[model samples]
Target: MSSAPIAAAPAHILELARRVLEIEAEAVRALADRLGDDFIAAVGLVLASRGRVIVSGVGKSGHIGRKFAATLASTGTPAYFVHAAEAAHGDLGMITADDVLIALSYSGSGEELLKIVPLIKRQGARLIAITGNPDSPLAREADVHLDGAIREEACPLNLAPTASTTAALALSDALAVALLDARGFGADDFARSHPGGALGRRLLTHVSDVMRSGPAVPRVAETALLADALMEMTRAGMGMTAIIGDGDGDRIIGIYTDGDLRRSLASGCNFSTARVADVMSRGPKTIHPEALAVEAAEMMERLRISQLLVADREGRLVGALNHHDLMLAKVI
Candidate 1:
């Protein structure tokens, strides 16, 4: 008997997937186009909220909901994820009257979520629902219904929630960026929200915050001998020392460093007999203590100096910073 030939998927299946993608892309674009007073009102509601945003969903929607909460929290907004299944088991306590609760369900009828809707309402927390079926029970009960409805799924079986989830994720990102913009949130503000990250160190760390201050600052008077300045440089481990003069101390007369010492010794200058003024490099580069650490890095790169003397607004020596300091603070 001849073996039955293996069946091949019809071209229609592939075509369906492509059509789903195109249709969902249009859905997202339409959502963007519909941005108007309602979008602004939603942002205002979130901004005025005194408590965190509580995101809850069931099944695949639950996974996407967690990511949405994380994205909002990592940006400027305070948000957290609550499992819909857990809501009935006292997880409802997580919701507060001052908070905004966002419920996500593609079908708008997750049994687990429906079990808690009345309780969430009783707690007086405002509810926002994202669902494909605007007339679904959840949407009917929501204070605002965001249309996450998609025409179809990318899955050939048409059973998986594919296009709908993608649309919801994109919408969540749009809301985050819109809120960030509305608050005039700057890079510095973002850095504050993420101090442990590299972007935070680059943006939020100021020269003064990481610089060596007080006794850690390498300093020597101009009248001090070259040997004493060299000792200060070595003891401080900054490879350099600032030379301060008398009076209001507005002037930086000279800077003595390991390189200067080497150059002086090679030029046959007597280290013991030489004064710091006679051997030090005149008018070395300096930076304000309030300058951003990134700006200080740029200055160091331009001037080819590993060490920088941080001065106050009056140009008086306040502290010192080095490339190693930047590296330690992770600003480099």
Candidate 2:
């Protein structure tokens, strides 16, 4: 690697950054005051449409449009992004007569968007324009025009599209969220759309999917010796073993864990011949295998437990799980 001297500027970098944030924040805050009849119309139009919601824009506005489309798509609104330039290059065919198009153009005069707005309208697709100019051609052509007009830009030279883009993005979010609420979208719907993420796993994974069953569950009869419980726990590597009564239809008598072992040793109990029932703790916590894994995790966390037993309605042990099992399932 070659050593090079770093170049330094003489301006107050932090002050300029702060001023930019203040301007953008004010621009977005002003949007709430502008939520009039037009905003409502836009939301109703998208909600009532039989087809998808297509978000289109160019440059910085295109970036925001992509995020807006993704949010809408994940929140139960069928939506996707189409670049304005690409639309003019034949992507416009994707828009159908029953679809709703949300066009983002801060200046309301982007040539690429204006070139295709007429085609979209002629095809019977409704247009929702988000722009800083109300009287511009694109805004005039829209079925619903959302005025994102800002007094000043965040740029120091007042040339870059900073505050204007931020306002347009915030407006897009407002419209998408309004539509989401109108559709009665919930967390389950969101999780369904994001099944590969942690939120999805937490909500969709059931205890049965992660619990140890059959041969994997460390269990022993109440008549078994303390050494037997220890052997079962060691074989299963779960740090605990379930103790069940022999004549009581194998009904749970108690649970023997390392904690119980420690206490028994501290009490000077002889493990060589002592029964597991003598040292096991009774009335151990249990869970249903059909319950959500996250619920099990919550229960364990609330009770400060490292392991839990899974039983059916008849009180028969079906499975077992511990913190390590939960971690393996990515449910912790």
Candidate 3:
């Protein structure tokens, strides 16, 4: 007997996936259209509250709820996820009367969550529910109900939660961004929340905080020979030296770099005889010591110079910063 041929997956599978995406997109669009006074009221309530936002849910909704909580917390609003199952098992203590509870349940009938509704109510925590069914227990009991109903699941079997979860995730993002805008959250606030990341370093780190200062600075008098300035640059290991005059007490006159040395030597200039003021590139690009390291990096790139002189407000040589400093600080 010939073996039965293995069945290939139907082409309808791709169509089903597209349909799921379309349905979920519609759900999110509906949410955007429905965002009238109720959404504003919800945001106002959460903003005026002195306590944190307690996001709770069960099953697939619970996973999305955790992400929402994390996004909210990172964007300036203090928030955390609480498993409804655990909340009924004494985790309810984490919620205070001043907190706002955002509960998620696609069917609006998660048993674990339903079991804790009364407890949350008794704690005086206001409830905001996202549900597919308006009449479901969770929705009926909430102070404000957000409809997350979808036409259908992406799953062919129609059993797995797919489109509903995507809609909920999108709504969560919208809520977090709205709150972030409402709070006037800026890059510095975000940097404070993410101190270990590159963006955080770029926003929070100042040039004064990382630039070499005091004795570490490579500097020479304007009257010094090019050879002497090169020696200072080498000894200091900064690849460049600032040439300053006596006026205004350390007024920068020029800057000498290793590149300048090569060009001078190639041109047959007498390095030993050429004064730093004569051989050096005059009016070198300088940055305020108080400027951001990232700004300093931009200056270096734009000027095509690897080293920059850090100066005071009055143009006095204060310190030095080079590409290496930016590399060490990870600003590059």
TM for every model, in the order presented, reads 0.79, 0.93, 0.89
Candidate 3 ranges beyond 4 A from true positions:
1-23, 214-216, 246-251
- The lDDT for every candidate, in the order shown, is 0.85, 0.91, 0.88
- Which model scores highest in lDDT? 2
lDDT, residue 109, model 3: 92
What lDDT tens digits, residue by residue, belong to model 2 across residues 1-332? 75896555647777788899999999999989989999999998998899999999999999989999998999999999999999999898899999999999888899999999889989999999988899998899999999999989999899988999889888888887898899899888888999988989999999999999999999999999998889999999988999887877657768998888889989999888899988899989899999999999999999998999998887788899999889998987
Ranking by lDDT: 2, 3, 1
Among these predicted structures, which one has the highest TM-score?
2
Task: Please identify model 2 stretches exceeding 4 Å from their true place.
Answer: 1-11, 247-251
RMSD of each: 5.1, 2.8, 3.4
Quick one: ranking by TM-score, best first?
2, 3, 1
lDDT, candidate 2, equals 0.91
Single out the weakest 10-residue window by summed lDDT for candidate 2. 5-14
Q: In candidate 3, how many Å is residue 107 off?
A: 0.8
- Per-residue lDDT tens digits for candidate 3, residues 157-244, read 7789888899899888888899999999999899999988999889778889779988899888988888888889888998888888
